[model samples]
Target: MKKSQLAVQLYTLRDYLKTAGAVDRAFARIREIGYEAVQISGVAAPLAAVKKAADDNGLVICATHAATPDLLGNRAKVADELAMLGCKHTAFSCVSDFQIIDRGAVLEFAGEMEKAAQELNQHGLTFSYHNHNMEFGKIDGEYILDLIYANAPHMLAEIDTYWVQYGGCDPAEWIEKYAGRQILFHLKDFRPLFFTATTAPVGTGNLKWQEIIPAAEKAGAQWFIVEQDSCAKNPFDSLKDSYDYLTKNFVR
Candidate 1:
């Protein structure tokens, strides 16, 4: 993967991006940290302001966590917003009302995703699903994640490495399993924090980056985004640490 492919998931620094000016400041810091791209999520600023900040920082809007309401309720609006931001890819993290209780539920959500994806495609945008640990559960003897992808052919996979490990699966194996169907990959390390597991800066935890990076690259992942949902110190510090590690090692 090239250094240009490495990005910061803005959700990691959600607390610092509450307004237009904050986004500008945070993005400047992000660019200074050596990230050339970012996945937009959890920011409160308007799309126009976001675009301006990104442009000023020389940061590429690689992907976004599309608002579920707009994605399911109004695809045209989501597409237009992404177009304004100059982003071609968006991923649905989750919906508040959507629940994956069984096989039927999974299929139902997949159908919705399929419809939304088709609509987005018409507007020159690609849609993907971002997974959490809950998706690792089984439904009708199949992993919910596998079932979702098996059914929603139009929806790509945006696998989160830390969550995959949190769900008790091998991150590299899953990336390899979904080869050629992924354009965005989340790179966060998982480790035991006292009594429970938590996310860490890339290469700072126990995750096998050497294997994960190669698998992700081979799987057609174009963006390797670092996201630490929770951090021990300033989120920007965590972002810099991850950027330093990836650029020095993986980004070639």
Candidate 2:
């Protein structure tokens, strides 16, 4: 939280950034709200267009979320793509067809991701796993997330604090447990008593950022990417509010 910069995960702006032009506007607005960086995910614009827009607004492309298919089908292109954005951190968001709750299934899937991680590493990119609550299901006395990470220790962990809390675990604990393996941390606050587990900006929900922030810093997290999966107000407003909360409470 005492870092020099904070970033917004573009997934929070997914619905708003539907087209090339819209993506451009989103970057400009993010800059206006004092966000110096962004994690690209669920963005549908052309890679060149996205890079140009980020450059135009002086917004750093900090990290990204990629689908499994893209990783399998386009490894080199993925490398080239991140290079285009001047981003070295990328992650596989989730598995599409694999059984996330089963240890055997997850280990096998982690094997595939391990291969991708190694290949991407050769290209100077770090490939990581981003978890959701579903990964918290226990298999043989161990969480699926832990099992998969244990089997594939080389892949980085992009821990989502909100999902970890949703899954009944302390985000700070996992951040501590994973220590040197965490390269990116997703900051999403969970508002209590909301149907479908509504998400709020960081510090607006029940999460313990007082503890979460120090834990992340102590564990040496590189970036805290703020993401709200659902916003009660305009998405940009939600982003600005999150930005204000982080800058006011954490750091500029």
Candidate 3:
């Protein structure tokens, strides 16, 4: 991917974006950190202010993690907000109270996502689904993530690397599997914690980025988004570290 296609998922800086003034400053810092684009999520500021912040910093609103409820029940409203931000893509973050063991629940959610994708298509916007480790569970022996992609053909894949690995699957293989249907890739790294793993800046953790980046490129990805759900240091520093690694090696 080109450096221009690299972006920061703003959810990583959620705490810093709680106000319009904060959004403006945070976005400026993001631009200074060398990110050309951002995925809007978890920002408490008004949409107008968010747009202004991006514009003021010369950052593109590449995509967003739109709320699941809004994607399922009010696609038009989501579309309007995306249009206002001049972003053409948005992803359903996750489901609520989802029971992975229930096959019916999985299929039901897939159908709903499909309907939402259709509605989003009408608005000339792409709809995608963001996954977490829970999606790897088996329902009647089929992976829930596989089922979601099969049942909801219209929804594009927004694969999160750390979550895929956490789910006990190979991240590169999954990214290649989606091929043409996937366009957004969340690059999150994880380091071993007490009993599990915790978020770390890309390339600093144990993830195999050398393999993942090539796989994502071959999958026709349009955005390579850097994200760390939680950081051990200042979030902006974490963002910069990830950006430095990506631009130096992966981005062209």
Per-residue lDDT over 140-194 for candidate 3, one digit per residue giving the tens place of the 0 to 100 score: 8888999988999999999999999898999999998898988788999978888
Return whichever of 2 and 3 wins on TM-score.
Answer: 3
- Stretches off by above 4 angstroms in model 1 are 95-98
For each candidate in turn, give its C-alpha RMSD to the true structure in angstroms. 1.2, 1.5, 1.0
- Order of all candidates by TM-score, from best down to worst? 3, 1, 2
lDDT digits (tens) for residues 1-252 of candidate 2: 643358889988888677889989989999999888899998888778888898999988989887667787789988988988899999988655456647678888878888889899999899889998888888888888888888777799999999999988999899999888887889989887745577898878999998998788778788888898889999889888888888888883
How high is the CA lDDT of each candidate model? Answer: 0.91, 0.85, 0.91
Candidate scoring better on lDDT of 1 and 2: 1
lDDT, candidate 1, 91-169, per-residue tens:
9986332468877788888899999998998888899999999899897789989988888899999999999999899
- Identify the runs in model 2 with alpha carbons over 4 angstroms from their true place: 2-4, 194-196
lDDT of 1 at 80: 85
Residue pairs in candidate 3 whose N, alpha carbon or C atoms collide under 3 angstroms: none
Clashing pairs in 1: none
Pairs in clash, predicted candidate 2: none
lDDT minimum window of 10 residues, candidate 2: 94-103
